[model samples]
Target chain A: MTALAPAASPARTPLGSSIARTLRLGVLRAGYEIRVYFRQADAIFFTFLFPVLLFGIFSVAFSGQGNIGTAPDGSGGISQGAYYLPGMAAAGILLSGVQNLGVDIANERSDGTLKRLAGTPLPVVSYFLGKMGQVLVTGILQLALLIVIARVAFGVELPTDPAKWLTFAWVFLLGIGTSAVLGIAISRLPRRGKSATAVIIPIVLVLQFISGVYLSFTMLPVWLQDVANVFPLAWLAKGMRSVFLPESFASAEAGGAWQLGTVAVVLLLWLVVGIVVSRFTFRWIRKDS
Target chain B: MNNIALPDAVVSVRDLAKRYGAFEALRGVSFDIHRGETFALLGPNGAGKSTTIEILEGYRDRSSGAASVLGTDPQSGGLEWKSRLGIVLQSTGEQGDVTVRDQLAHFASLYPNPRGVDETIAAVGLADKARTRIRALSGGQRRRVDVALGIIGRPELLFLDEPTTGFDPEARQQFWSLVHQLKAEGTTILLTTHYLDEAAQLSDRAAVIAGGELVAIGAIDEIGGAEARVPLVRWTEGGTRHTERTRTPAGTVASLSARLGAEPTDLEIYRPSLEDIYLDLVRENAEAAAAEIDADGPTSPTTRPSATDPITEGASA
Candidate 1:
């Protein structure tokens, strides 16, 4: 058989001309990621269903317990269901964003998935975009599930004003974005797939406990409040609370206000931190090299 | 070692070396793979085969060396450069829940030009299992999936690292035929294996590596030099056994029979196979290493024999 030289067509193809094609491939990768994610029974149960289950249990247990606590303005206390609604929704974002990506990316790195993809034409940006897209879509579905159950079963009142809805939209977007980036950053901490959950779960669990997801923020001591304020989770939960609770309820927060400005700034800051950390941490192969 | 890159060489390496702390994995090894040629790197376990391929694949960086794959330095190769090479890693843990077809289709989308999903599946002999989840497949079947992904990109140079490690004989035959098909289609392949028969059957040229160094490199029939392949004549005479290495076994046997005035008892002629030459090369390298240690003022008796133990153990089975 006659021999042929290596094909020269794609060798000199400039990166500038392939941006659109890379984006298309990224979208295609997202479709594949979502399909595979849904097929896993364990992933669906832990990521999507866990938060909804928590909402059900909390609302049912505290059904007739009256208000969670009284407001300073004497306008009346916030209902137990309404107060926990936003907290659980925020937790949903954390689950789908940080927890999901941390373990998933670690597994990919250890399993040769990242190495195989690295050898291909797929850009690293496209890989991250696929992950971010999965988190965005799954995070939205999870939030909707929590919100629907809260409103229908527990008779909780969601805000009707367009301004409040706008607040919810931006808060949700920023929260998931920061969470996705942080997830990728922390994925490098695990040395192998089996230890990924052991390494990541403790961190996520500690954040949920201290960040006002499981308990009332004002009830937490001042020291714990200060610690939680340093992280993005606290800001994310507070942002969600502002969207669902009455404006007067800001008096109950640690700062004695909703602090939407600081919430935006802190979450934006953490997003930058996550980006910087991941730029140095993410690798196509294991660290043995 | 030749440092100049051949005009049509798809892969060229010169004085390539890798060090893991104080341990040297590859010690200044060099080779060239010409366009559309099937080149095999044959070695015992941990003889730097995978290390060399990983460096060429850009999965690992060499400690000190020069490597050119597809006419580009692998360390700086970009997406355009990566798109032209196919890599089948030694072992991989790919997504198990996805169907074979879905997995192939997704990977196919990342290439500028890729083989059709169904076509690739059929080419790897997995047509019936296209809809099957990867986790449900057997070990050999999963290996085929790995091959399917590697070739789906239509790479100009394909790296197959111990590709048929888990395949049965029939499956290996099928795999070889598939490789032959790729060769016929002008796909350059670089393969590493412990199977001498595989190297003899599939590669136009082969290199034998021992203890992180290449000892012999040439065409399949010419490796280890003609001296290593000389015919051996052995026979028993007067309650003593004698053996001679000769170029013409027939003439030697005739001379021996005429001198003895009858056919020598239990006369036999043996021509060394590829495996015999490989074992001889590895043994010679080990002896040289042992002699070097002796000249350095012998440290221990215990460590000397261990150097040659692996060669004997590997050759036994």
Candidate 2:
């Protein structure tokens, strides 16, 4: 028998196999996150349905009086159902995208999942993209349910015009994307502190109240209204109002437009800020600080 | 086994070092692993065992060194090189309560020509748990999953870092046998472990790393493995004790047989196991640290005694 085997041809790595590897990596991340969300359905239940539930309580308590005592556009007593619908949508979007993505990503990075993914052929960017992909899929589904609940249960009028629907769709997706980035950016700031929700709660509440989602901008002290106008929450509330409410109900002023554009711009800025900070942050192991 | 003769070297290293900030985890660590054989890398926690294995596996970069694995620089090797390499990292996350068979099948899809999932599961002796959800599996079962993933690729060079850490005694023995089966299939294994018995059982050759340096390397039996050190002998002489150290234990037993005119009462001959020598080496390492001392290098006669193990040294993995 021969001591050494004869030479053989050089091996070729199959192209199909490499593609399979990369796709599998993405699939693993997305699948695991979905499973995690399902496992923690109670938390998810509060995240999605609680915002709509809260809207039901507040809309009727202040119904028929109009959110604004003084209509800047001079439309008299616009329906409370109309005004609050858009604001609630914005609040729902923020509650779902920012709170969910920010907290989950932080916890994933902390737990060895991100570190494990760091070694795979999957670039860290792919993991975030997969997360984005999952969030978008869930957001659309959540929005559909919210719209049905509003139109059918709460007797809130939704836009039936096709052009208005297209506008609604674009702005809705954009708002989701924008706020998602801001949430991610915000998530980066509290890296060392491990209790993700503990840190995010105060920030979410402060923005929600001060941005005038709970109280109408028209009735807010002029100073508070102006301050709200300068933040993304104000923009989200105003832009969303323009979508679901009658045009006459919107503040016929620069501030309403400022509300939408500023939230978009600030969220985009936070997105950039988040990306930069995450690059510098040392992701701790998943279980501990 | 095939009639193939091993080459001079499959792995070659010179002055390998890795540092994390102020700590030098591996200081000028160096050793060679030969072709078609098992080489154990042994050390305690924080002894740079993981760092060295990671570098060899191309998962981490080294601070400084000229180290070649399977003839390619571990630092710069590409997919062409990586295709021939396999790595089982220390821990893998649960793939969300997936069935063991399904997860193995999914991972098997990544390799161009992977071993069948069923066969791999059987090899790791997880046939009983094939249908079990991965989340329900014990730590040892999870490790079996890790090993299944690693070898699914049929890599020529395999890196097993702490592969049997959570394994039960029976599972550990089965794992050792599975390793031998892989060797029969010509997969060169680089193993790191805290268990000396595993090193003695699985490795044809072994290396010990501590404080970022290669303390010793050679055939497992001679590289300060149990065989290099003399066996301890003791007997009762009229209620008093007697003792001696020698390389020949059975011969010592023969002498005792002749002297006592039968087996001597209370005769006990203790052969040095890999654990005994390993403890001595690690202890010697600790003492050397305390005394601020550096011992003689590879020139130490005991280290290079005789490379007479059947597994050949070589330039292939």
Candidate 3:
């Protein structure tokens, strides 16, 4: 038998010193997750790069000189290219944080990665927080890439006011919180690692089309508009539009307004509901059901 | 450090049972693993060995009774208590894309004090594969990675569930040595495997569990009983073979030789192997179950036996 060198004995410390330990361990776990996420070409392409590509496609297709919608000033027409910027940005956030996050969580649970971590001394909350931290980092990068594509390719104006940026920040945070929490909550439905994509992608695609990620919300039928309004995705798109679009586009919205209060309330409610449901529904490992 | 006296038991389980609705996975199983000892829980598939270990590891909840690991109840074991325990699961519980070194380093940070990541990689014989993605490694290499993660925490108690299932023979040898090194350093280990020879080779004591109950448990040689430890004598007489288990095998063989007026033809003496005892014990448990069903009516709800008796017979060749 080949013998390897023995490990040096670790110095003893009091047990359960988790306040400091949690932060240190959470950082390490987050770093590990980020490294692995970047290394997987498939994860990068589908979660981040796919959104950038979509941004380019949507911006170029809508860049025609023709004016198609009511301008923010209630003028006869608005630039179609400008109309798509926030829409694609909303889709990007939903794909990376909600849809992709669900698939990742499902894969991890079925693959026993979550189970292994559950057996360790690390806190369970730390595991989720660390993973969410990685998702937030990636989500920011994905959003940045989309914004860059919009400004460069479509001549979309950047938000000039600091208040608009503040609005953008809160909307982004609440949108990500709601979607990522829902992502974790929804992962309980997929029993197998391979089926996560099968279950999540189609739903994301349908939601994207219906909620105006692929087209203007006004183009959808009235019933579809009502259905879209009930879900957080539609409100996310509306919220993002409020941050990027001028004030007159509010008339195109369902209530003829951005409904910023409703956006915050609805997203916050979803976030809270997602957390509660996930606490009850999440399984560390597969069950026979 | 060489001769520090350790606790009487690092793991103490008593009357532990787990029930999933009406189906009972563990039926009041009990065992103890003293500090610095390699203990094996030997059983067949679905024998509740995994259930028992998992309960002790705090990965699953138990229905009744008590389990203590590192002097704390595993059910509510705090992080400090958890840090002292290492669990090597049967499945590959790692990201497929992470490099070996990175994975080990990440797990190392979870514990308060941990073995160096590079050293752990070498200890598990994964130095060559340290930079390889887990998905790119072979089955045996992944198993090594599992062990590396299990031991990186410098746990006082380690739980390994079928740790060598996919290992090649050489890798298995290396793993055995790694376990031995851990034992020499006074790490208490509780292992479960279907391999009887592994139990005999590595464990100071072993418990044979079958049908969610412990059929027998003791020192490897003396598990079945004193008679099982004794040798059996066999001889051929007039084209027929006769065999008898006896504590006084020497006297029995001498008397048989004298009666035959020479060495008996095809004379042989052998002690019952651990496998022999284990298989006999399992068979006895099954027969006992069948007998209980017979004694009780088919419609009887209490056909499951409340207690199992270990059979003393060791006729296995």
Leading candidate by DockQ: 3
Clashes per model (N, Cα, C within 3 A): 0, 12, 1
lDDT of candidate 1 over A60-152, digit per residue (tens): 788678676565664576678888888898999998989999999988887778878988988887888888899999999989988888889
**Which window of 10 residues has the lowest lDDT sum in candidate 3 chain B?**
B308-317
Residue A274, candidate 3: C-alpha displacement in angstroms: 3.7
Which is better, 2 or 3, measured by TM-score?
3
Q: lDDT tens digits, residues B1-317, model 2?
A: 11121354566766777654444667887677778888998876767787677677665666777778777777666555665667787775534456788777765654555677788888888888898877788888888888887777677778898899889898898888888877876778999888888889888999887555677778888987544477888888788988888877789879788988876778898877888887778788867764553365544322312222111001011
TM-score of 1: 0.91
Q: Note the DockQ of each predicted structure.
A: 0.39, 0.13, 0.43
- Candidate 1 RMSD computed on C-alpha atoms after optimal superposition onto the true structure: 4.8
CAPRI-wise, candidate 2 is incorrect
TM-score of chain B of each: 0.88, 0.82, 0.87
lDDT for each residue of candidate 3 in A1-289, tens digit (9 for 90 to 100): 3354554554555546567767766777777778778987888998888877877776567666566565577666556667777887788788877787789988887678887877788876576667777778888988887887677877777879999899999999889877877888888777677899999998888998999888789789999988988888898998899988887678878778999999898888888998898767775654321
The model with the greatest lDDT is 1
Which ranking of candidates, highest TM-score first? Answer: 1, 3, 2
What is the lDDT of every predicted structure here? 0.84, 0.67, 0.79
Q: Per-residue alpha-carbon lDDT of model 1 for B43-124, expressed as tens digits?
A: 8776778778888998777888789998888888899898888999876766688989988998888777777788788878
Report each candidate's C-alpha RMSD, comma-separated, in the order given.
4.8, 8.4, 6.1
lDDT of 3 by residue, B1-317 (tens): 11121358788888888765555667878777898889999877777787788778876777887777777877777777878888898865456788898788888878777888888898888888889989899888898898888999988899999999889888888888889899887888999877788888889999988888998989877798876667889989999999998988889988998888987999999888898889988889888867777888575443333343211011000
